[model samples]
Target: MAEVIKSLNLLESLKESIEKNNISDIKDAVEDMLISRINIALVGERGGEKAAFINSLRGLGVGNEGAALCPSSAAPDELAVFPNPKHPDFRLWDLPAIPSNTPFDPENYLERYKIIRYNSIIMTFTQNSSSNMVAVWREARSLQKDVYFALLASDKDTEKTLEAKKKASLEVLKAEGVSQPKVLLVCPTALEKLEFLMLLEVMLGDLPEIRAHALLLALPTFSSTLVAKKKEAFKALGWAAASLSAGVSAIPVPLVASMVDASIAVRILTKAQISLCLDDESVERLARQRGMDPTKLKGLRTCLLSVEISKSEVKRRLSVAEKDTSTATTKLVELAMPRHARSVSRSFTVMLQAINSAIDDMSADADKIIAVATGVSQ
Candidate 1:
């Protein structure tokens, strides 16, 4: 268990180092850690429906009345967290289904929920005729990122109803410019019979790739494989912690305390980066200029910059360069284009040369700091 925690810390350090553009030594270190940890999360709407579907996928027996677990009656606005029954390292957060009658207000509610935390949203629909699922689809579309959908069609003979619902859902998604929605259809009997394992496997297979894509959009330089491996390591460590707790007598008290402190530190640092990444204007501007989808960019510029300037004095110096050159280039390009692409290109080349000269000048100042620090230590 201590080893597991250490692996997680190493993986995180690798991620931070890469973000800081200091990846010369960490590649092998991360690869070595990946062999021991693999973790995944299952997220969907609450009410026992999502749980029942997950249980079916795990081959758990459904109760006798053909009625699966009852969907929670709690207000659909709260976040729900549940542990994966089959995989100790995995967690499933069952989100409250978006209410059909209530209109969504994007401004006030966007950042208040856990919707942004998960790798993907697993939207479940009851049969093809259910309009409730369509409402959910609409809400997911408003957010403008790829979402995965699963259809839980009724076993009853509502074939036409099911068909109509599916058609309407697809049309709405298409009109909103969503090209693909990962769709899965399963029945109550299938849930009871534990036959949904195949579907679960398919979904699971695509998860790592999807998550990799998300991380890449946020931090282009950081490899997707690295992010996935880190996630896997975190899960493994969590599972190890749970196991250690189960046989409490076998574990020493001080070791447990140290492990808990490390886990808390990891979680805190991860959360701190969220705001920095999402709210940076420079990142959003660069993302737009590059023809990269903003949603795809996931506010990575802040993450990149944060690592480069982790020290307070270094950060203050970088902020000056960031403010001056970053925004002006876009305006200059806009003003220069079509008068002559070649002329504009030449101007940009000159600008980059000047920037490089300025950076070299700044490096001399950094040398002075290093000299002073070295002398003080001596």
Candidate 2:
């Protein structure tokens, strides 16, 4: 309940910030969201696990060009950056090996890579935490940066095991003054942890609400819970999108009936498709992963964002809907957007129906995908 209230407050705060167009208040948020650049540095001991984890985040196979560099021995003491193959905006940077012989300098190390400048940090561990890692963790926290603790517990285990690992990590971190270290026992490739989703939630905290909203929309759709979060993230966007449609189409023409800005509508729907990873390519990849035909998967797009509907097609649907002698759609739109909708309200109705209908369709599509992936019918 508190979380829900917090979320609502943040959403409203962010919207207010954006609406007022206060440059300083929103410059970082706008830059982060618009550029879609989220820098997360993996700082830890040299090992293949962290490297493999980085690759898994990219969704690439073992031999792919941008594959996570998994070295049997210590990888060199240099930073390696990997762009998310699916999401160009998401980046993973692997910090250099921890020097065993020399005295570790957190300030110099952080400065050398400018890791201090990254949006987030993940200190990866398998066996146990190290002093150098603890040093970096304290340094990052001291600098007021978001730092997460990740444990590569790839092998499926009981919830008991997850909690035990998290508890131990928490105890160690508490001594270092980290009261609550968000720990994720995630298998990077499979993404099999509720805690992983929780970790993402943690990362969004203190960020501008709109920036958080953008990150939620742009995140790679991984879990059903994540899909739900994405939906909530987009709920407020519907009105803005509808307004854009209405605003763009308010030309001085004869009132022939309801009208919609097809171009704006198309752009909105296209962005939703891309943001939700429901485009042709993403759907195909998902299908292949499930050993199913991509053709069969087209019907799997129950989520409006995931559905493969184009702008022209959406426009056609809206046009048909406007003349369909259908008062039910018209009434629904009327009820949804009645405030200050006097002159161009009819056009608002057209857009409201178009977007609302897409939301319904794409939500179902998301359900289908989750059902297939989780083997639990929605």
Which is the leading candidate under TM-score? 2
Compared with the true structure, all predictions reach lDDT values of: 0.38, 0.61
Task: Provide the lowest-lDDT 10-residue window in model 1.
Answer: 215-224
- Candidate 2 on 78-118: residue-level lDDT in tens? 77777876667777788875554548787887788787668
TM-score of 2: 0.76
Q: Tell me the tens digit of each residue's lDDT in model 1 across 190-259.
A: 4322223345445444555323322222221112232333334334333222222222212345555334
